[model samples]
Target: MTVIEIDGLSKNYGADKAVDGVCLRVEQGEIFGIAGPNGAGKTTVVECASGLRRRDGGNLRVLGLDPQNDRRRLLQRIGVQLQEASLPGAIKVGEALRMYASFYDKPADWRELMDEWGLTDKRRAGFASLSGGWKQRLFIALALVGNPEVVFLDELTTGLDPSARRTTWGLIRNMRERGVTIVMVTHFMDEAAALCDRIAIIDRGRVAAEGSPRELIAKGRADSLEDAFLVLTGGETA
Candidate 1:
């Protein structure tokens, strides 16, 4: 099912056009990827779709409801982890998760969420005291606490080490198995190729190209998605 639909979606910041006439359709129960070079307005597109930012023009819908008009209703069914999402330094892991759970009408058991994400041991740890990987684990657990149908993960593993990144990838795969639809944004083409069911390459506030990993490579006549990204985006590196 098409859980998200955007048509000619546009958002501007000052005189700069952050997103311009961008259109996309995201199916349910799939990991959709939004990828691009820095400053390509990838995050802005998601913010508008998730109802965190108001668009200057065009329209968008999530789960058949307008993001702008049905934001309050939608919040109960969707979760969002922004690229720069963070909590107060002094907050404890358990405290953060519990607090997030309280916002929803029907929430998951936060304690089980902690154990499921391997965060039980870190429950007492302060946000500033945890490692990078631990913090990310907490973030994902918090996102899922609302028992959402859709979750947006922006730059999910930007700074993790190889092992931690792989571990996080496993967690994402597990989410898919449990029937959660995901929208992921990433700079790493390899990660997108590995995890995404479909990907859209955004550039200059618009979609440059979109398809499955192999289809995209075939379309660009490149050996890899990274190479295909460079080819499809006119030499812009992702």
Candidate 2:
């Protein structure tokens, strides 16, 4: 099943083309990575696909629904973790989770999610008091609280330490096992290499390349995903 489809998608800021004529398909129950240097339109593509931004051209569908025209219905079936997210400074972790849970028709137990993400001990902690990694974990919990079929994780492990990053990666794999389709936007080559079943490298508002990490490396004649990324995006990998 194709969970997401985009063809000739375009978005612009003034005269600048942020995303231009990009096409891609994401299958069900797969981890799809969108990677590129900053301002390469990677985020713009997802923002458009998720209905956070309106596209200027082309067609897009999420679960066979037009994200722009069917936003309310589509939102119920998908969750998005933006590149940057925050809660009110005074909101406690548990409070935040509960609030997010209320948005969906059917929600997972926030308490269970807190325990699963190791946020149980920090339930009473204010959002402001939590460290970067803990905050990320909480955001992830919020994203999944709705029990969405498709989840967008953008820069999910950006500020986490190595240990926390690994733990989060494990959680992502577990999510895939449970049949959730994921569209991840990340700059971490190692993260993409380890987690993504397929990757699309966007550059200058276009898709520079798309393939598995190994295939990309082989095609680029590089030693690793990192080197392949560098080669594909013309030395820009963010």
- Per lDDT, the best of the predicted structures is 2
Candidate 2 residue-wise lDDT at 122? 94
TM-score of 2: 0.97
The sequence of per-residue lDDT tens digits that candidate 1 reaches over residues 1-238 is: 9999999999999999999999999998999999988899999999999999999999798999898999999989898887788789999999999999999999999999999888999899999999877888788888899999999998889877888788889988988888889999999988999999999999999999999999999989989999999998888554
Q: Per-candidate TM vs. native?
A: 0.96, 0.97
Number of clashing residue pairs in every model? 0, 0
The true-versus-predicted C-alpha distance at residue 90 of model 1, in Å, is 1.1
Q: In candidate 2, what are the lDDT values of residues 115-145, reduced to their tens digit?
A: 9999999999999999888899999999999
lDDT (Cα atoms) of all candidates against the true structure:
0.91, 0.93
The CA lDDT at 105 in model 2 is 95
Alpha carbon lDDT at 50, candidate 1: 93
Model 2: pairs clashing at backbone N, Cα or C within 3 Å:
none
Off by over 4 Å in 1: 236-238
**Worst ten-residue run, lDDT, model 1?**
229-238
Give all candidate RMSDs, comma-separated: 1.5, 1.5
Q: After TM-score superposition, what is the CA distance of residue 140 in candidate 2 from its true location, in Å?
A: 0.7
